[model samples]
Target chain A: MREPVPEKTFIGIPASDGIAIGPAFCYIPAELTIPVCAAGTVDEEMTRFDMACKRARVELQSLYEAIEKRAGKEEASIFEAHQEMLSDPALEGKVRAEVEIGETVEQALVKATKELASLLAGMDNELFAARALDVKDVGHRILRILLGLPDTALSAVTETSIIIAEDLTPSDTASLDPKLTLGFITAQGGLTSHSAILARTLGLPAIVGMGAGLLEKVPSGTSIILDGRTGEMIFAPGGETIARYKQIKAKRESHLLSLKAAVEKDAHTANGRRVEVTANVGEAASARDAMEHGAEGIGLLRTEFLYLEDTQPPSEEKQYHIYREIFAVMSGRPVIVRTLDIGGDKPPSYFPFPNEMNPFLGWRAIRISLDEPELFKTQLRAILRAAVGHHARIMFPMVSDLDELRRAREIVEVVKRGLEVASVEFAGDVPVGIMVETPAAAVLVDVLAEASDFFSLGTNDLTQYTMAVDRGNAKVSGLFQPLHPAVLRLIRQTIDAGHAKGKWVGMCGELAGMTKAIPILLGFGLDEFSMNPRAIPEAKYLIGKLTDEKARDIAGQAMSFGTAAEIETYMKGVLALL
Target chain B: MAEATIQVKHKIGLHARPASLFVQTANKFSSKIKVRNLTAKVDFVDAKSIIMVLTLGVMKDHEVLIQTDGVDADTALGALTSLIKNNFGET
Candidate 1:
């Protein structure tokens, strides 16, 4: 007799960084399929296909109209494109051709849809690559119609647990409850997939591309240990592995507790150079979490969340109340409120934007705000009003040129004038800042520095735009490199530009939280670093260890590199020395 | 067959709403319309297929050859040329 070998471990790509030990919550989205059946007569199958197409069109139309009413015109346009894809003659012709060859209606539709999706997926461009998702979305609508199945519900994740799935679509990612989701392990996806990006945005541990058949091999409710930073997974761990993971988790928790105890003190480098540590929060509730994690104040308070999942735009009073609530929680600490910075791939279900080939480089952020002054003024007024009794500042996203910044300032002036005329009490002199997220802005940092009160380098968009890599596209996701020499050089240049003009600069992007980038950022004389709440203590700990002189030398050496890989390898060398 | 080589004047080239509008216009004429993206030097694709038209990956300043044959060849060719010249209604 021979003993059976246990399958206890798996390796996957590290999509988000962290560690988690939780009960596995295997979420299987209803597979796209049709009942097994023989090929019907050609006319009958075509009629069935046509009926499904019509139903899908109606569903997509309602979706478009619904999204347009509240979220705005840009978000609603996605459904319009989906509707167009449904009525595409090429797709219909292919499905009909398949039916003529004696295939069932379901089989022909699935085959045709998949072929188009794969074709788009195979393209090198991000726009075409994104189109693949839309194709699959339309395909699933048709498939769901044929299968008579309801939509998969991800909203009911009420308990904290790790999610294990084959893959998650963008819609599934959107529905994920960050408060309840501990982490995610998917069998298929790259670092830039929607699921991965969602994990990062929500500050959850995740590993993707873990290989197929994970769902079948690993049962639900199984105890699992996922090390997202290391991309390792342990299933049904033995006594020693469990003990080791528990010990590590305990040590990490205690370290965080100690860091939280020291929350009131300002962070300074070994050489006594002080830097502000803040948190980037999405909602009013997150202000408490940020304080708990030792954040001095809110650095980037995203106001866009109030605009989503609603039937209409949040009224000024509603927005004012919410902002006041967040301000009350902060207790006079500075909260830099960012206005609705939506467009491109980040649109909600409701806005309408003209179809553009390269959305990332198209109308978005302050551009959209400038175009719609009423919408922009409402947000500015709310923020200005909130600052009346609290420490608050206004920061605009994606200010690509001097003209855009000047125009934004003009609007602020108008809003201030309106407030004064009405005798409304508000913080009129609250500093105005613009996010240098694009190369054009980065290049014009010195000029922008003179006009603006301060600067915050949005490293996420800066990295993507500088590298020309769409972070949402998995195929080129790896190229969304923040450590590239060009990105580092740009940061260094922006910091210098800000300092030379006597303007303080801060960073409130994913790069600010990355441990690997901290040393260089610290060396670059960055005045502030704001990030997710959970990453604060670790960043503070690392900052406490490095001398300003050492960090500057390392940053200087890093800029001389020719490629991202070389810089990465050198960084690892520097980390080892530290 | 009637044909004309036109430079796509739209700032974003022949994609998105422009591509959709181009395909919709081509479908209106009673002619078998085909297009070849000059930069990529690819084979002709059915001008009426929005999906296929997007596959060309044409950009602003790229040249494209539109060919039409049948009863409304001249009309179709003339309309497409004007569409390009007008920058697909883009300012």
Candidate 2:
């Protein structure tokens, strides 16, 4: 077979592993169309719409059944959600009006999709927006896979993942097996898409927005590399690239394995300064996972989950019951409770809120609580009521100034007095604290740290805000370096500020959990760490082996480094001494 | 409309898993068809695609999509409405 002078292909950074080879197929989503009536009988259109809805319902049921068979009975519920959508009085009924106007099946589906998308998009709920994406995704996947030509395999290649036409839906993202599948690549996605974030959090490497026609060129099992860090893609790379990649990959693998293998008992610094490794948990499942991973306790139990999950506010009694369950399991380990951190990217359904063009910089966290004292009070009352007998601390998220800090403390004090008057045996004087996530909070750390019993730097937000890099934006993601001198300075400053006031400082961000960062945290004199449960034992092990004196030296050297890579190498060198 | 026959060059053929995909695409417009062959004509398959094209027993070199209609009739016919006209082509 004669091939044209093979166009020299560009290579990407290798993020995931494995090989693939199959007929390259690409899926380009057709823009949806909804009918704007010209002239038609409403009754006829209604009948046709009904027929289409029925057909959609039937298709959805079969899809659900198929998903159930492949996965399990529990997962079948996602499809049931689709079925419910079909019967939604507002959703299906809205489209039914247009269908009653005699829209074709194709037109009906498009109209229905846009209607639902617009409604879901408009909602203040983050979960609603997520669900809307799922609605479009599951429906789109089923429709496309059903109609696609040349039949490609949704069935995965062993050890290699199935890339997609676009980013995967939330349900699909959740269902993937981490080891057997590397993760998906898509032609249309931002770094913040649920799939992208989930993949990153799971430590599965992924790159998005490869543009269209990816599936057409990159055949499955063809020895391709997905470089998530640099956003590079290489196909049929030569031995040099492969060998260079293998060395880096092997070192990284050994690094991860070393974390697990390094697992010892209690955490301590080089000078025998003890550090407690805890997990930041939102659910019972994650709490259980934290205990499994050797977490000392839950650092921040976000009580806002009650508000996020339901159609209305969770009554104080319900909130109390949840707290009792969570704290009881801790077997007396401290559970620091953070009040409602609503608004911005995470919004409540019932709240009348604004969609900020730049959500991270918008009215969010404690700003919302300060502005709406009543909502804040109701939530505070609920937290205080629930945390009566539990190891609890009243923590606030996003406190920028002294007034906000002073006002929040006053509210907590008032609530405690109220609880005491009611003759309730409660943990009335819960340690009140604020997440030092913003630059303003870090800048005002000395004053704010004095008012609170403890400080916890949410480095995820701090890194994003300080660098002015929207981590959600791939173009600037490189700039979201936690090791940036500015960020490092704030972290060091926040820790010092907290300790100067005799307040213990901790971190519950991704930065706190990085294996290399353990030494730096030790140097910073952080007393507690909160991360995913899976990372606890590893963090504990890393911290256990470190000496405070050695860590202090490493941090000093790292801050003076030129690049993040250099800082990592410097930190790794320090860890070697252990 | 004029009809042309093409082979399935993509190897896996038309009927099995690929049929539904072909159908989903075919259903994109308002068109009608009775896909058949030199041997036997299949009548009244759901024009909505998700099932029709897949039933063609479409394998490599198989021919199908005998008839079609609607506004973009010729363009649709030239572009796609006629499916018995591909070889999954080699570049």
Candidate 3:
């Protein structure tokens, strides 16, 4: 007689969408322990070291080629740097010095690599610290080859399965095969972690931050069902539960297929009201992809990537070239470039940020831009130069009051004047807008509209500020609802106020692409909706199904409700009707 | 011997890809090349060594003194100086 396995359920933060049902491949990485050994004569040890270096070089060359083929040259450049480090004369000399002192080859390699890693890690800069990790990775790879260990644990996965791990490193993520790796469930990581971002990029369903106990509950080869959209996971599911999830998976796939089929159609209500559907793109490649998915324009082009990677701010020419690349991709479509939004959680290595308790509410974004006039002018000049013969608009972020808007505009004027004097060709009539993220901005939209060309509601920050909930904090994450009545009221107010002043209002947030919120936003008279590139097709398809009058009625009924839960339930009912 | 004192204006100083390029340039000559971080008051290290150049902790706007000695010392000095002056061709 055999006993059946009991069903177990776990919840985590949803990092990507779609459904996955397969056996669990619990990935526990094997740790390498170096054996203590006596050193051979210097000549023999040197030969051994040379052989290992040759092997490591060959391994890195193939790895670089593979990554370049799968990802791109930019991604494979890391391996190029690693190859340089492996052959570095200084690193080699250090190891040789250690071996001459009677240290074993393994010990010499470890000491030399650690010394270099520490030198980089000792720097106060974050970029150098990240480099330290790269050095450690390269060192470990050679160490494994020397020890005669297998390449990696994930390489052994030959069948289709959902991977469950504590967390996946960059190397672990690089090794994942899209065919065999169905999804990922990690015991740790937030929505913006490396693994989570990689999962979304790979179009793989993922749920993260399930806590440390997830690994204990899920053994290898356990039957698993996961919904990345709902962050629901079931282990050792019974037959009934499996059947139910299978239906959900089939329905979602069919729905996606139908939406993608209508990707070329414009987003228009049944009443024939046209609303621009766009994308919030971070780079040139995403901008091109957004256009291919029928994004009307780029509603939000974040300009932080250029500054985040380096130890100092990118030069004016560098910023110009990058902005031009994106503008060229958009091909005369309206591209609203949001100025550098940093500080808070995204402090760059070059800039010294004040240690504050409430960084979100502290000196950030427009505040930093205002204080650093030279840096602000550099970015403004670049944007102006890049906008030549292109449909480019500049938008400021995190503006709470009219003064920050005035001061920023004044600097723009200064940059324009300087460009004219210096004979620099630039677009003179570029529209300047403000992100209505702060409560103060939303409330004073009409007053601020007098000085601004347009308004774009940044609902993510607006919701966080209105609810006073940190979206990243798992404890209060449930409260960070963008569809809440309070947030809806703010959105409604911003749209109406902007319209009254003859300014078009747009929304570039997670709420914009949400299926349940689109109809209500349409009723609220939002001129544009911008979200992730992946969500554009579905949002457009849904918008084409509703009449303006019915959408207004839904919005009106939603407003009558007092709480977020009530509004959410009401929206779900309305969606079912559609 | 040939030498030059130049400020590193590359955004990330003499590190990452820039450091690698610097070492590659130094290795093209038969001259013995060494560099010292004047701003950090660090001693000179072999310029052909990526790890040695990085250990100088040179950052943006930090002045570095480069010295080269051999038949190709002048050529090495010219190339290194031009590389630093051009911001390592990064822009």
Candidate 4:
């Protein structure tokens, strides 16, 4: 019996989003060329070399200036050396001396540059040795000018293709034209690497850190599917797989058109039950974008970003102006402002937050806010001041107990009293909310809902705390499932309790943005769905397709499942139907 | 005639920009400057030529002798020695 053809699917770190299907363009490093020519007049050859050098000089200077503008001075300095190499008389004289002999201009330039490059390459100092590449680059530029050849490399990508390379340096990634290049599949790089960042900026699908051996295993010109979503590189994919990818790509393209149309439309169910799809903005700039993307309101304006970059906390006036600017753009639309949920991953260096072995479970969010009442009062006063003529609401993060909620509410009253005494003409009776992230808070939602105006389910932290799995820790990340039975139970209980007390519940977490989790979330009677601005259109599209009854049924069915896998698999089937 | 022995203190040694900077400095004076790689025991070459200077493969900790033969030879020697000692301002 013959062995079946082995599957050729390679796994890599997904660096950018999107699905790309194209022929592989193997990036072979360009080699310096020198064509042998019959001896022309020595003066003619000399003049040609000089003209080429002059042009090369101008080009290198322009390149330096352009690099300085794009990547800054440090990167531009590399081309400065190239420009100086143009002025190197020893190199130029050797070429002219060769031209003085029988050799043509191209031959002389190549010979002189190669000799110098080889000398540099043969050196023991690794830094000096790398100069060989710089010498070769200068030589290639000048030779290409003389040879009447187009600058290749990036421009060489004539047809639509995926770039398969051992690794791409910042320079290589910078040279790629997004129009011609379909995507990037490099053998080495991380998600945060420059190659990945550049690819993302250009909207090119990218997968990195596939290991260098991947280049040798897959030859150039082979049809491959680079799924950046799943970080899979499938070589010579079967007909079904190709057809499926084509369908997905086509659907995505049309989906964009549909989303653009839906941008101005209300996000609602087929039965006409309106779902308020809002944005989780970080700054005034992002708040404007949220409004443009048809966010009914700002769902979760994380206030931590204001204090993150600065050494000192922002003044009340500074904070008030920022909040006012963001709220002004919303134009009476509701904006839920979450208080500074700093500490854990986002500990500002200036803030003397004690380092803890288990920060996520330790003092963070409301714990810090309650301890530092002065900081809390300043933020609250700013929010109250900005709330004038705007539908503004304040929410506290990591509220685990009724005392924490009451203490935060008391501070809000103190700040409001101060603002009133100053006759600051601010909004009174601003509704206060709390994030039900801790399991204790979720369980006591009925009691807390009475004290709180609303509840925003921070499912990300809720899952982390509930599962006792540090989501940041990769080893146990698989266990940190938002859809796990335990997390789902908490979410269901919180929503029920909030509604029972006549308060609306909203979710502003990774789960809220997930299309797969929408059916269950909508069924749980979630009043508001908040997420990244980019996810609003799709969220609206999916929400419009779902009915209240079907969503409830899906949620009810999901709750019956004992494990997250069961719910996930069931959702996959339901998603396929949709 | 003026001569001075200097060590290549630049972290990257006499490569590219540093070498270009050295050559530019050498060309500022009317002095005919020549450099020899004492570490490699190579013959002295024109210090004003970047390619010849690079060819010497002068690296970090490698000693070199800069000799000048002109009216401003002493000034050239002082400037070149300081440039090398200062690591071409890279460090």
**Each candidate's interface RMSD:** 6.8, 17.3, 3.8, 5.8
- How accurate locally is residue A476 in candidate 2, as Cα lDDT from 0 to 100? 84
Which digits, one per residue and each the tens of the lDDT, describe model 1 over residues A1-578? 87633538999999987788888888876677567889989999988888888998887777667545644564456667677777788888999999999999889988998998887787766555656776787888887887776655475466888889888765565456667777889998887665676577566789999999999867888888888878999998877888898888777667656565546567888888888889999877688889888888888999887776353677888889899999999898888988788876666556777888888888888999999899899988988998886889899999988998999999999999999999998897899998889999888999887669999999999999999998899999999999888998899999998999999899999999988889999999999999999898878877887899999898888888898898888989888776
Query: What TM-score is obtained by chain A of candidate 2?
Result: 0.57
Tell me the spans in candidate 1 whose CA falls farther than 4 Å from its real position: A1-264, A344-351, B1-91
Question: Ranking by lDDT, best first?
Answer: 3, 4, 1, 2
Q: What range of 10 consecutive residues in model 3 chain A has the weakest lDDT sum?
A: A125-134
Error of 2 at A427 (Å): 0.8
User: Which candidate would rank higher by TM-score, 1 or 2?
Assistant: 1
lDDT of 4 by residue, B1-91 (tens): 9998988866567876788889999989998899999998878998987767887888777899999999999999999999987668632
Clashing pairs in 4: none
For model 3, the TM-score of its B chain against the native B chain is: 0.98
Model 3: interface root-mean-square deviation in Å: 3.8
- On lDDT, the candidate that comes out on top is 3
Judge the docking of candidate 4 as incorrect, acceptable, medium or high.
acceptable
Candidate 2 docking band: incorrect
Task: List clashing residue pairs in candidate 3.
Answer: none
The candidate, 1 or 3, that scores higher on DockQ is 3
Candidate 4: residue A422 Cα off by (Å)? 2.9
Model 4 lDDT per residue over A1-578, tens place: 98644547999999998899989988876665666559789898888888998998887777677656765675667777777778787788889889887899888888998988898778765556656756777887888889787656577788989999877755466577767788999886677555686677566899999987887877888889999989999998878899999999888878778888778897888799888999999888788878878799988999886786455788888899889989998999999999999876668757886778877778789999999999899899889889988999999999989988898898888888887788888899799999889999999999897689999999999998899998778998999999999999999999999999999899999898898899899999898999998888988988888899999999999889999999999999999998
Q: Candidate 3: DockQ?
A: 0.34
Candidate 3 lDDT at A425 equals 99
